[model samples]
Target: MVSVCRLVGLRAVARHAVLVIALGTGLLGAALVALGVVLIFATDVATVYFDWALVALGAATFGVSLLGVFGSKHESPPLLRAYASVLLLLLLSLIGAAAALSSLGEARIDAWMEEHWERIEATTLVVRKDQFEALLADHVAALLTLLACLVLVLTFDLLLVWVLQCSATSRHRRLRGEDVERKPLRASNGAGVELEAVAP
Candidate 1:
């Protein structure tokens, strides 16, 4: 009885955790979509291709969050597993992209920024080349701070994914345990003997 109560409590806690993960993922998706929209219309920092990628990523994230919600509601191990796997893949891809970008070094990043600034300056009279160069000089510290924040956020996301996976695994184990328990109960009731007699 104690083990059963403990199992129930753990299951409840796991369900609540999964719900929180779904909410977090949904908010993340909405933020990404909003950022993409803002960038596409109000800023020249991102190209059209990059803007679309952000929006697509947001949509996929929101969809996965919905999957997690349903999975948790139904206590379906398979759906939860699928949700965790897709989220893990997305996180890994983001990490890889970040790694590749960082490996390009400051010179490559500066060149890319200069190229974009020139394109923006050509199209608009608001920003001058000298002013942009000065701005870049001043923003180096800000850029580094942003990089640090990104690392922290990635670490937090990894922990969230780990929690989600553990919840799925625990649910699966509970299901298997229940099945095993039922098998012995079935034999204790002599149902197998009855079935065997009928078969013969």
Candidate 2:
């Protein structure tokens, strides 16, 4: 009974991990497509480079997730671990990229303000400064949102990896006939009869 329970638990964990990987990859791919569209239509050439970088990262993550799913199907621990490691590396890369883009944005905004202070001042007096500030805030907010999404996806991927590792370990142990707990059984004898109880 205990062995059956463990087997069922292991299968459930593996299935959950695969599902998470698949969903994360699909969502990341769609997000990348949307970001690509936004970059082409809304951003300038200078910022477009960063968007391209993010698109590549997203594509790589999607590929890794698919690989993880396939590896899990084969019940290959080494392949699953490799896929997980790649995902961790990709997550780190995304963090670095987000930090770099934030720094670049700050520098660009400072430079823009420095170069167009006089024009901006005149325009502010003639036009509604609130509208301009709102636009700037919206852009920054969107960037932050994207970063948050990346972080969340990375976290989910890590969790899936952990679950997969645990399940794989359990399965390996079971395959090696190590699932049963063994212990010395106390023996009793009465009137030429002997009995022993197994601890399972």
The candidate scoring highest on lDDT is 1
Candidate 2 collision pairs: none
| Cα TM-score of candidate 2 | 0.52
**Which pairs in model 1 have colliding backbones?**
none
Off by over 4 Å in 1: 1-11, 31-51, 112-200
User: TM-score, each model?
Assistant: 0.54, 0.52
Per-residue C-alpha lDDT of model 1 across residues 5-99, encoded as one tens digit per residue? 48776556556666776878789998999998998899877564677789898988899988778777777767767776775676676567567
Model 1 local distance difference test score: 0.69
Give the range where candidate 2 is weakest over 10 consecutive residues by summed lDDT.
121-130
Off by over 4 Å in 2: 1-11, 23-59, 101-105, 108-138, 177-200
Model 2 Cα shift for residue 35 (angstroms): 10
lDDT of 2 at 104: 74
